[model samples]
Target: MASETDAPVDGVLIGEEATPIDLTEQAEVADASFAQVSQVQTVINHIHGDIGGASFGISGSRTKSRRTSGPVSGHEMAEARTRYERHESYEAAAQQLGRCNMVALIGTAGTGRRTAALNLLHDFVGGRREVVVELSPAYTLEKLATREYRKAHGYLLCDWPKDDVDGSIADFHLREIRRRVRDAGAYLVITATATSLPAGDQILWQPPPARDVLLAYQVAPEIAAEAAAHITPEHAMADVVALARDLAAGAPLDQALGRLESAGRRDVVAWFDAPRSRGELFEMAAMAFTAGLPEASFESLLARLESIAGIGMEKADAVSADDPMPSRRLLRVAEGSLFSLSPGRRLEFKVASHRTHVMRELYQRHGMRLWEPVIEWLHECAALRDNPSAQAEVARGVAILASVSDYSYVDSTFLTPWARGNGVMRSQATAAMAVSWLCLDETTRSEVLRTVSSWTRASAARPKFTATLAWSGELGIRFPLEAVRMLWLQIRNSEKPVRHAEIALARLFAALTEATGNALPMLDWVARQISNDKRIGRAIDPLIRAILSVLSARADGVGIPTVTAHLRTRPDSAVPLAKLWSAVLVKRPHRRDALAALYDAVCAFDERDDDDRDHVRALFAALVEALPAKERPLLAHDLRRYAISRNTDENRLEILLSLLRVFLSPAVLSLDTIGKHP
Candidate 1:
């Protein structure tokens, strides 16, 4: 394996800016059969977080009070004050509130009705902070009508229920609410769907163009304009805001928009649910699964689908009767040139978002009647050794299916069968990739983690190995601490530690250190593990090897080792680094590797004109202090012998010997001897 420094940092992981490990390369190194699963690597590279850039959910410094019932928190209000974009109806609504002391803002869902209401109340109260109290959505017209209000304060009621027993919205109720607000010298804004209320008191609201909302969030104008091109009247303000936030965070426009459209629209469901020929439905399924593959691959998969679904005869009969051209039939469901002269022509849906929707509806609503055949087809595709790309695309489709369908059902039907036993490496790779995908969505992430964690304890090596591969890829990148902890569990529980588990631990640490440019957290974790056990037990050999691997790994075209660079960036990490190094030196098997890595770091620091030398000296001092007095002389002798073998200049060798001497002085030795006696 290439050193960490020589490893090229690939694309970013979803919701995180981390270097993704090339699992295919790593897998091949362990088992040559894994070379055929290269498509797994490609799938990992293309996976992005869902819209909103939150793998878990949108997180910020804003307080939790934003979601609670009370006066809106000052922090939340300040945020809204900057990002709120007023609709055309906002001014008219504002004027009504100013004159009547209350106004009802009505609009279709996702039109920013609630936002307009909040803004109106904020302006009506003259922008006084925390004066805007958000009333519960459960408040009925009767309660609101008789409710007393605070003078000079603003009240906002969002999405007030229409089915309240107080009866449908009436003119008398509006008049009473208005009277109450005016008498109290307060303002109230009620946001609701279009209702049979008096027009004089209600303003039908329409949100501004999606671009304006994006701009309000400080999104780049070009990106916002491009995103706005795809926005339709049906796209909700909330989804658009999420899109803007994602675009601002440097997410690709197409991927973000695809997730937005897939989540926001149900057109795909309607299309699938509508009456359609069995042949056509099968064609759609084939297209959904093999959309990006070449035309020949599509035809092969489609034929397999038709055959499995018992629609081949039906498809032939329909073609004989209607004689519709293949392109025309394909045009009905998908959008690609079937007759393109190019040999590499690919077939895909007109709307890329529909592919996921198609698979989701087919697997969920259609159930096993469709899923059994689809699973069989996916497995066949996974077994295609001649077309690794097709196999990869199959894995991608399976991941999407797993994400959309009932997870347990997918697990039973597909993941379990492919992941356990002597299943082909390609199939196991697909299962592992699917688990990684499940980890990307907030709804499924925890469940996926729990399931994979359980798999680590399975008696079968393949399942455990699959779980290890899942963590070594995107799962580890997104949740490094959890990934590390769970991997340790797998390692400690094994009767004999799996080599793959050891390699995965190393990759996880290397990728994390490369991405963060700081190894302190990982180094600190190693220190804690060592200190808690108070012995360099064989159980922690994997952890020790991982630390050494990181220390020796180098980036491409960079001379400094990963650890040296980390020390230069954060000199304080030397303390923890030394502690881990001390453990490595005493581990016997890793002693030589640890010393060699330390010598390289010392040499790199010696060449620099900065304070990095002090870090090296501190590291050496801590390393010596952490060792037993009986081991210090042995460590010194090892360093001298290792330096002589390397044939380095005397200055570098003298630097190491001198630090060892200072920390192992007669006074320190006597104190260590006394402590051991005590």
Candidate 2:
């Protein structure tokens, strides 16, 4: 045994005793090629396909097994692909490694050097030499590095220090054979790429070993011609050179090369036969190669071939929902089939929660489609949320279903009845469902306007109060003249003050009048209710004051005179003082001609009442003595209209009319003298 520090020179005639590192390091050693960790990762990626059944278990003991697949013959699908080698400039430095001493690949790593070394090993060290020993960085301790060389010799053959591993391979978790190889002084390797290795026992990649090992896998000329002639479909030729290169990788020989050539394959020659991006680039080539393999070939030749970066085969399930609406439709339209690769992933809407992670793994490792199968599931899951029973995402679900701002159509046609309708779900389910529809999107607002027109035409004879509120507040309409018209009518027709009337008033006045306009009905209702419910009459005063304020604002020499003549016939039933103060007193601030008439009427009524036993009889006498014969009919009509409008008796009307006739027929008497007549 000898240390690299004290090694004897060899090329030591072909079969002479090679230096044994095991004695120096007190560890068992074996033989293996030297390569870097990145190269190892590249090869491992290809071999890792269809591997779910091979789960890692708590291992005290285990048996080894190997699987193989056939290869496409060089003649069958060949191409005269130019063989290329990684430049020594890009190579990571190599060194003797392990306590037992094996050829160790060492370097302050550049780029493709490690992987270039791994690729060479794939061609030369075709058998068990394929296995790689991945070592964890924590095993820097000498005691840990050589711990498992003897146990691992049968299964593993190379050692790659995650970060400068030496000494005990065991401490670094080296595969047994890798440990032995390092201890045996013949295997050297590097491990610095992947955070973890799937299987350590496989040839990953390396620089060409012996010339025999570096055999260029070229196709026959005709095959290359044929393959080259067979151009990829024009539409599939996005990044055309990439496709041509893939075609070359798949064709058996130059026989196909002519075909590829005839197909104008050289048009995309830039992507042919070179290693650029290890993960995706390699996977695409592998997939294409695997697809083109001949049925008759032995799979053993292709077994443990390097993996396309992070790819594999798995069982795809029937579509699962991501949302509630049109889930099936979305699935129907996808171009590719769902492929299950990783577990606990697309298990749900389980989309790539992190784009950096998914995108990096995919692009960095070869366009990994880990979320594709589940991506559609995401689309479908999005649809199902609309089905209130499936999930509780009402806002999202409704957003999906709505073609407009209002869901009134859904309510009228489907949802509202469904809320009260018999079904597996109700209450919250119904609420969610209704809410789903209730929520309006940009388009739904237009739909609401259209529906309102239809509603209006249908309700031409009826009122449209409900529809109005539905449009305004609920739908976020700021200016709706149509809505306002409906509100104004509802207030006038209502039996008493309704709660929505205030909401209607506030919204309408704010919109149309800038908070200045109000209907007279509110003032009338408040006054009547207050006077009737005397206990809270004082509470009504402020509102009355506000009404007065608005009325005065409306009275500035306007056309058609907003002042009502309707109250003139039935003044007792009207708020005369309120109206007068609001209109004339507040606005004019000066004497009014109309005030003299009111004062004269008041004086006449007082003089006639005198406490006479026949109060009505004396008032009639006073009224008749004061009037002229020509006005009798007009006075009678006024009294009649007043009583009827107030819903009072005809008897009161007759008494006033009769008193007016006392001074009729040119027999009028003085007002003071007429009091004795009763």
Candidate 3:
């Protein structure tokens, strides 16, 4: 089999940015069959705290030890598929394909109405793979697609072979197909309008989103300059500056706008093109009137010009907030108001940009309290069926409430029926996670679980529920540990468990920090969780050792001088970053003296994605701090071989230089005699 080389991933993939709290591609692979999987060293991105740029690699083959939730009912779906000879041998192939990480069915889709029914059956019975049931037996292509949840992947496939429907169906499916591979890890291959059944797993082909495009805009930069020639203006730079002063000093911006509105332009297009100081507006208007163009069209021309690209607007009439922050509710911009300290610099107007402008405005004016009432009003408006912005209002409301950790009060008026059905539940998985930790009666807790379960999609219930259960164990909730153990047993094979587990751990850590003001204790506690694993040390031993190393070196020392900053973040047993870091300093061949080898390891780990950089830095910090002062010079020298630091040189050269310094030191080594140790 051919190896999967470095393939481009879709979306702004994890680890692309700095300060990621997730997994990154840190190391390389040299193992056969999997060598390529790890060879392409990439930055590790943390997702919901699961670190895995490399671990993100999908390992094929079904997990052998875990049981399927519903049944091995792929057999039943296969049987239904064979009934019409439309998809024969459903059982023979479905049964033979045991423990496949994914399973998919391919057949020539026609206008068969039963196609959807068949696909649903395949999913309900044996959903270890992607299944599509749309042969489009009836109705138009668009109609069928819109009616049913026609996702590209996720145990569902839809096909249309009629008329090509002007190719819109293909385009629509293409988006979902690409989404399947990127978002959910389902590989997709659309046959366009063709309906030939294919052999197993033949659709490992790449999706279009995986291909890179030149991010530079196709429109040339010079186009704006070319277009800037046409707009005429009524405003002069100086006049605009004065106008901005009055408005920013608490004069209503609309008042200034009203003044412009009546200036009587005969509905013509004019643009000032220059900066919109009040003086500039006046100067430009004077120039336009002095010129041959009629002054009547000035306002109209100005409005149109302002709308066009590269044209200026006396846009900020109020001194709105300068920054754009989604969180920090009290922080907001005041539009049309001046904010600068200097008199002349005092200016009206502020930046007008926010995806959720309404909420942002409400926040600026009254912060969260008024925001609550505004959302209530929007909710009332939505109830009256008039507020089109209700959804956005509700979403912002949710964000505001969430930022404050008022999880119990999640706003529902903005939640779509579908959101209530699925999205909220996915989001709630974390918000309501405290329930697992909070002291509560088992009966009451069970009731809460049942209520939460009712809100989620049927498929999502167990995964979410199991995740919560694992969380409860991590929190040291006064429940039987067996419940936690059982939940793990149920989901050990599922793809989402580890992710949920990691999330649960993060929350558990947060709660501990809030209560104890420490992170080191979590290590000893982790031992309890891992020790309970039936497989004994096999499951969490590596994590135990790894977490221990990070914790052992943490600042629990006396006098508080050694106190580690950012106690909220600690190594999780799952990530075992210490082990990964130690590999750099460990044994290497020939060019592999311990320090030199460690330098190389640091280099390898350091060459990671942007998101992983901080984590790598943290690892570097921990490793250095862990060493005794006596060994610091030796280790620093070893680090010179590979560790690259932009501040001085790359990690290697820096480490190598430090090592040279140590060798040159009279107290450290006698460099004149190569064979002699210091």
Candidate 4:
């Protein structure tokens, strides 16, 4: 190994008469002032360019003896001197090192400990022509005992002795080296990370505060302070140094920023979006944009921030309003008492590109616990005067509510006024309100139903509403049965068709059927309205198709209660129920319960003496015959059994005729024990 000296022995002028010792060119001695290697130390297997080199399976022989060495000449000592003067912390450490007999400069990498050690050595010599011999734990004891081993002023040891090296061996070498230095009346200065070295008169050379680092790179004090405010003290200096070097080399901005974090801190750094914690800044800015700056008051704003952050005021002081070093993400206005968007600053939080990402992080992590506070703040905003911007702010709040699925704001008091407005804000607000309705808790949903019910009665101007029923159907929210009945009456009484009303009616039918597990109420109501007024039925045929489409997608059978209720109450329900059964059967023929219910309804002919029963039975027979061949036998058996059990001949004959007509289908060729019809 090369000796830790700046030049060869002949270079130094030690008072002109005495020749300086060539510590580098000395014989490999078995005796010296420091311990030397005597036994085989531990070995490690290493990959030599296994990535780009071949592997060395075992590195046992490679653990050879190495002498610990130190800087011997002042050739490049000027560079070390300049770094010492640049930062106050380094200068302080150098001064402290001058007074200690054995000083260890300890810190993490990039903390500048070695520079301080070399500078401290410079102070120790007082410009004398002396050299520092660095000792290694690997030196053999016999080599240390050799007579030719006496050296100059002091010894230097830096990060040495690999961690897995035996502890007793390392301690023996360190003790021998200290004895050699003390016996020679010489100095010993060791520089290492905190993890490796023994406790001593240690001078911790932390990276300078960010300000000094920025100043070193020629950053203006104010700008540097602003940047410094964004990062922790431990990180600020390293980031500044990396940034300055990259900027000096004209590296790209991202590349420069990427170097700010070392590998060990990558995960912690990822939590910060811009080398700083800007999440709180963006959230407060979002609140300010609508609430009016400083008008909200600092204490009140801090409380809101604290609430969202879910921390007490004292614990949240770093990002608090009282933080002396506030982020440039927001600017202090009015002599720092109030805050607002900085003039000419072009607030990045407002940019559409990053806005959603910032908002998502805020709501998903921080604002999750602030739901009640956010709702109250929104209520305040909603009370603002109905200007376009105020309305737009309220609309934005509605959108935020939708994004987080916070649906407590679906009340008529919050929604009705904005729903009636004109323009883009109104449109967005209307859609957002519908989404909120669909996402509301069951209790809130029930409240919304009552509100809509009241609104329909109280509203005479034919209030405009969207296909909210459709949205509810999509979200699986049960549409209110009362709203469906009320909307059906409007359809029946209207002289002309209302498009939105029809869409709403269709969605309500699907939602109610999904909720009640049957289409009976919806079908009964529609059939009753149609039989009472055929004009309305013709007007609502499109709605019927839409509802049927929704039901067909949901392949589950209609409930038995639904069939029994409709069959007992309205004979008119048979044909419509039969049609629904056909629609469901066509989609899912394997739904045996639907087919059985359809058959049961057709046979419940005794409950209805009207002529509609024949049409219903005929429709049922046609649907039954249309089933795939595999499904025909079981359905025919069910029908024949019902027919035989009929209480009267007229009922039995009506059913038999329907059954016989069904058997005539080309697909149904078999005859059961009752008789062969063909």
Candidate with top TM-score is: 1
Task: Give the TM-score (vs. native) of candidate 4.
Answer: 0.28
The stretch of ten residues in a row with the least summed lDDT in candidate 3 is 36-45
Which residue segments of model 4 deviate by more than 4 Å?
Answer: 1-413, 424-439, 457-462, 467-476, 509-517, 534-576, 579-619, 622-678
TM-scores for all predictions: 0.57, 0.20, 0.23, 0.28
Worst 10 residues of 1 by lDDT: 55-64
How does residue 571 of candidate 2 score in lDDT?
29
lDDT of 1 by residue, 1-678 (tens): 122243233334577575433333445534532332323433443333123332211111111221223566566556566678876688889889889998888875557676677677777786666688877553556778878898998998765535334435555677788888899889988776644356787887878888888998788899889889888775656678778888888888888886665442367766766787767677777776667777776777788877887875655645665565566544543433222223457765555556666776676667567767876787777656567667556656666665556556667667666666242355666666666555544334444665666566665455667777676655665556566666766665555545666656665555445444544555677678766764346767756666666567554324577677777777777678777778778788999999898888778885345465566665665676677768888888888888889997877667666666755573542223321211
lDDT per residue for candidate 2 within 82-167, as digits (tens), equals: 34344342232221122323333332222223343333333322324324332322233353445554322211111223333443
C-alpha lDDT of candidate 2 relative to the true structure: 0.30
Of the candidates shown, which would achieve the greatest lDDT relative to the real structure? 1
lDDT of the structure predicted as candidate 4: 0.42
lDDT of each: 0.64, 0.30, 0.30, 0.42
Q: lDDT tens digits, residues 85-195, model 3?
A: 222233433332233323333332121222323443444333444343222122233443344333333333333233244455545753443444444433222222233
Clashing pairs in 1: 4-553, 5-553, 5-554, 5-555, 5-556, 6-554, 6-555
For residue 62, give model 4's deviation from the true position in Å. Answer: 70
Query: Every model's Cα RMSD, please?
Result: 15.0, 41.0, 27.5, 35.9
lDDT at residue 521 of model 4 (Cα atoms): 48
